[model samples]
Target: MESEAGEREPVIIAFCCHYCAFTAADLAGTMRQQYPTNIRIVRLPCTGKVYVNMLLEAFVDGADGVMVAGCEEGSCHFLEGNYRAKKRVNYAKQKIEEVGINPEKLEMYHIGASEGPLFARKAREFTERIRKLMQEENEPENQIQNEK
Candidate 1:
């Protein structure tokens, strides 16, 4: 997982809703489902409460990837929280892309409280994707240095 420049393990920030996403993560642990340990979960009362700045700050502070996990469509405890979160996540993705990072580094997911396996699977997948992206980001530097 270390890059050529001694890059450490990828750090992933996950904003999870209390009602669904958080519960799902808890269930994942209870079920002994395996996922990446690099993810740092931030519990939110509702996904709608997540601001774009919060997500951006995660990247600025060295998170290689970000994830917003909420209740399934039409099932948000706050009625429209998940929908609003989806829109905000999309907006953040675009902004990050403008700054030269791949938009794929940021993602949104909807998970029910009972979907522990799915949650774990997605977490693992996201971590692997970010690891690949980090490696890609370093490849050009390595090539240029090699040419010297």
Candidate 2:
């Protein structure tokens, strides 16, 4: 579902590796597949290049959820870039949660060329999760914080 103007749409930013996940996303688009429209895919040369601050910036800029998609384990075009990304994501997840957002808001997935369908499915599933999170847990705390 598309986010409306007044209602905060679950904004999801997907950081995808150029070699695998990004290409698969493009293929999903080419195949005329319909996935959640809320996800915005950003292509990175490797997941390793994504910094912790970059993920935080997405939330600061209105992203309700963030996802990093890279090549399957031991299948990176850049050898171990995805491994580095996994570590960074874990750190960022903790940091984000400490700052009052749910750590589940951030996720990581690895897929090969043949997993475009899975990529699409993941996007859908993440979007749903974000939607539910937003509905159930987003308001009370923010409302209290805003009153202060």
Candidate 3:
């Protein structure tokens, strides 16, 4: 939808693990790093707590894109939470594609608690990517409507 600035704004949902991703986000804020305001973060004890259904529900609830951010590989506080989160994210990607949404709209990221800059960069990048995807998805329909 268009925001007050008259620019199309996609709703991006970020599922972040408290041990790493969430902390990184907080650090980013403290560092005055800027990311897209369209991103809505949902904090989780661990990325492993993320489920495919939750990802799908985000879309159904009008999220244009979803991101699951977890600890770096082999560094999950729960030992294997990141690994399980990765698997679920991959599965969710496939399912989202089956429903005709761009699979790229959903992604998983491995982040260290110290990577605040990386977190901000990724949030901006992902937001732009989803914005482009949404534009592309609507282009054909807009053209058809114009043609009629």
Best by lDDT: 3
The prediction achieving the highest TM-score against the true structure is: 3
Clashing pairs in 2: none
How many steric clashes between backbone atoms does each model show?
Answer: 0, 0, 0
Ranking by lDDT: 3, 1, 2
Provide the lDDT at 87 for model 1: 97
**Sorted by TM-score, highest first, which candidate order results?**
3, 1, 2
* TM-scores for candidates 1 onward, in order: 0.90, 0.89, 0.92
Q: What is the total number of backbone clashes in candidate 3?
A: 0
Task: Report the lDDT tens digits of candidate 2 across residue range 119-141.
Answer: 89899999999998887764898
| Error at 72, model 1, angstroms | 0.5
lDDT of 3 by residue, 91-119 (tens): 99999999777899999999899999999
Q: What's the residue-level lDDT of 100 in candidate 2?
A: 82
Clash pairs, candidate 3, are none
Model 2 C-alpha RMSD to native: 2.5
Off by over 4 Å in 3: 1-5, 141-148
User: C-alpha displacement of 116 in model 1, angstroms?
Assistant: 0.7
